[model samples]
Target chain A: MNPTLGMYRPRNTPMHQAPAWFKAVLLVVIAAVFVLFTDPITSVGLMAACVLLLISTGPPLKATAQGLLGIVIIAALSGGFHVWRGEIDRAIDLAADLVGLVALALAVTSSTPMEHMLDLVSRILRPLRRVIPPETMGLMFAITVRAVPEVARMMSESRSAAKARGLDRSFRAVLIPTTTRTVGFALDLGQALHARGIAEEGDNPAPYRRARRVKH
Target chain B: MIEFLDAEFTAPDSGARILEPTTLTLDERRISIIGANGSGKSTLARMINGLATPTSGSVRVDGMDTVKQGAKVRRVVGFLFTEPSSQLIMPTAIEDITLSLRRSIKDRTEREAAAMQILGDIGLADKADVSVNALSGGQRQMLALAGVLAITPRIIVADEPTTLLDLRWRAHVGALLRSLPLQVIEITHDLEAAARAQRTIVVDHGAVVFDGDPAEAVEYYRALMLDRAVGEPAT
Candidate 1:
């Protein structure tokens, strides 16, 4: 199980089977509730509910904790700021609300498969098909999701290369290679897209083909 | 059939020849191309699918001009890159396959079912939901092939598809590629794999230096490499 944030985890649960639109609406409603009710007790209770929901999905506890580390750092910083201004109760409320929202988001993403999200994006963009192709946009979103780990890997490689030359502390050394590699990767991806014949008008636009050819 | 009618490529910026004037007809079931680094072998393979257009002459697949009918030619020809990560655009194996079938299969359920069937055929059924990043290099290459096969391409043009795989995986993928019914034009540094092809082509310094029997072509390529290693200047 990778500890990357917002990555889908395979599971068998109601949340996993739920449709993308439904989960999105539920997320918005829950988020609204959290914002509307600012009391520390209510926020903490909501956060607990979110955590339980996440646990029910059966993801590894350690991975989940690691995935939430970024949010934790931000929450701590905000809380520290409030505490320095002598608003202890406000800090607790704010931190709890932030944690609850992120946990709920993680629960939704971990349960929902990327296909569902892509389908939902296609449906949402269908209305704007005249200006932008829905299929192309959906594919773009998928590629963006795929590029996350690749960019991270490239960044790690750049850091190592810099360290080898004793330039690890220099931002320019890391930034230059990472940026160049990312651009090259993008060029490769563009060629792949072209080779795949995506967003091309050559293929027939038939809604359904009666024949499904076997794999070559 | 793929035809290169005096096809040639030149660097747009430097105006240097990448592939010299070449006239060739490719109809073999398996064709292997071998060359040194920057020898324009990749440029030749890319032209088959219109990824790299010739500056002067024309390349055609089944009589369809690559420049004018590139998209249609791409449907007939599927390309595989050396690095599978660049080609696998979707987050998961099944999703990537489904994306490949998007134009062919319209119904979502049917597309997904077809994707699953392809995954199963490729021995990746259990890993369908697994993230692409988590898969081993060989598995990712297999997934990329699955995506290419989902489109049912008549011709598969692979540019060093197995160069990144380990020895065992290279053999596995090589055997799998050989088993395909479609015409396969592969660019390889692996002489043994090239020797297994029906025909072999040796490219050097923007020209087809040799094209004939597989074993003979391999010998020619080896000799060419030796000459270069001994500090021979370009002809």
Candidate 2:
């Protein structure tokens, strides 16, 4: 039920202070380079660097472990798949690269606060203002980050309620209520948006529209 | 006056008749609807905001037809549910309220300012930027109220808004609702809240069995409950 996007453990580390966009761009670059090249030394070096970065970020070891659970499973599956195909070295390298990239990104999120991350994203997106309003993108990122936990909480509660009612195993029992609750939540959010005047006026394009325009 | 003309509702799941045919007019500003679970009180409140349309009957708010003008009616009738968490859509407190003003203000700065003003009014201005998940129960309810109030609705419909809170928070929220300037229609089991309202309606078996002054309505409901308990004993 932990719906949070990542375990953003708050810390006063240097990595947290670094701009989020910098980390984002770095992650993309590393991922692309790792995938394109087959140098085992370079992959090992990157993996070592990511481990060091994660240790310095100072998140609870337990939280870090839980957050990386998915990445670990994916890495294992890919590595096993490669070994099954008799490409052991290539599999190990691919797994190392993928894990290194994911760990680096997780370190950034774990160290940085959502507000700062949003600010960094907005700053990076500022040039595309003519196409996409930076503020809207910033707000959207903040909301997405915040909603992760909220949605997870909702799903957990729904599951519990379904279990208590002895209908947890029934798809109709679970799906119908969960979907209804989700839609209800969305509508309530929409109403909240309307009340707070977040809706775009007839003349104004949506914030995403601006972002899209900049990309074009 | 709020009026329901031949109100009847069919359950969405089984298509069973839920609300029996009925008609009533409510003129009092503060009214409470009390009923047991599945007694149809919640459905009755939802009908006011057009959240639930009657299968055959018609609901009117100050003479505006709920079925014919559902959207317009919703603008004037702000609905609050017992679970504030479900009602809250936005991640942060101020952002949630700001979202409600999306149509009223074009400028982001102005919208934020207005949202802050509302938070201040609700005594939550300091928590404007805070994530809503971090809020206490009372604070979350206040934020939910702020979200509803940001729209400047004239009527507020709350379905057991305080049922989840502790005794202190329950009283706090009840008092706050009673003090608001908007017309309040509260569906609750809290007898203390019923005492504060100008009028009360007791619903049983999907029908309004009692309607009048709060004192009389409470007495009637208490008697009905007692009779049911005694008569159904050992069954």
Candidate 3:
């Protein structure tokens, strides 16, 4: 199974040095601004700036383009729907806004490691420590992010194995094992955490307080 | 050293017994547990680290109770599964090892440094930052070993670690596991590996049928397989 998502590319760029939470907050704010303010020129400018920032990250242009394929497809489909409804200008503006938002989000993901992003998320969610425990949330986020590429790899392997066995057409054969294994993995991880003393009750204080302390 | 006292395991769902009540002690630096598929051998090996708790009886690692103190037991008992992908929980090789060190090393920078040191020791220093998914089967297995080793457990239990590897890679991994300083308990179907271990235990239907010298254990297992084949008429 190929586990590499190419999202955590190691680089010494300034963007990589910025605290992950700051970048995440900035990306969210930019997205909200793009959605709230609606001039096509403004959207295009923001989109262009995001593209330039992406280019400066030094990931291959082809790789970047390949990663953005889903966004591109969504933009095209939404634009088509808008034109079909006879709102051509609105469609173009929405497409630009969507592309800008996607680009901004991609930049954050590309530059930030999953651990840092989870830490940042945990830090932001620290105030809810009484309700949901920050470390648990951090671990959940990290596991979810980490499991995405792993699950994808397992599914691809299962598909190839099924195809090789001439059972590629059977969705049950592929899906059953994949789902079973993913659940098994989650259980194993929970066990591992318990074994490692990381999940013990009253072991760590609320995550937000820790983050605040780190900030100072 | 590891010891099992009157251990028995029954499948919770089927109510079918896998491992019959059995007891044995292992003090060898390198030991192998050999058995056929569905023979309850892996379950027996897992009991060493509290991975599989016995339905009855107790398992002890150097006197630590497997059931009552499972977390404490696991801290000193490192486990390696047959599939490295199953053991590796992180995205990158270095990160995977570092995750294991989260408890051992509190400082993030020191944790990363120590993980790199372990990677270098395991010959995976060059692939530290590489995504674990891109590694070959053998490389991934080595990375898994590195992750377990990073925790610096006293005893290592590996279940069919080389089953998925080719011959050369199998030998390479076998040699690597053998070279470690920790007490090693490997569960495998590989006779050659069994022969190399300081002691061998041949398990059948969940009980230790033969426990002694590696050569005698091999002979006992071979004969047992032959007896089974003879007992069954041609399909």
Best by DockQ: 1
- Taking the tens digit of each residue's C-alpha lDDT, what string does model 2 give over A1-216? 233334455467887777677777777887887888777678878887987898788766675677677787899899899999999888889888888887887777676555455557667877886676666677677666666676666777778888999987876776777778777776766544433333223223465544332110
After superposition, which runs of candidate 1 have C-alpha atoms over 4 Å from their true positions?
A: A1-4, A31-45, A86-94, A202-216, B232-235
Residues B1-235, model 3: lDDT tens digits = 7888998888878989999998888898999999889998999987888777888988999898887767678888888888777677777888778778876787777988998899998788999877777888999999988878877899988899999999888998999999999999999999999999999988888777888899999999999999989999977
lDDT of 3 by residue, A1-216 (tens): 223423677898877888887887788888887887777777778888887777666665665687677677898899899999998877877888887776777677778776676567667777776667676777777677678877776688778888999997999778987888788877776655544434344335655334422110
Off by over 4 Å in 3: A1-6, A38-40, A125-127, A161-181, A184-216, B233-235
| Complex DockQ per candidate | 0.44, 0.19, 0.28
Residues B8-82 of candidate 1 have per-residue lDDT tens digits of 899989999999999999999999999999999999999999999989899999999998888789999999999
> By TM-score, is 1 or 2 better?
1
Better of 2 and 3 by lDDT: 3
> Chain A vs. true chain A, TM-score per candidate?
0.80, 0.75, 0.79
Against the true structure, whose lDDT is highest? 1
Ranking by lDDT: 1, 3, 2
Chain B of candidate 3 achieves a TM-score of 0.97
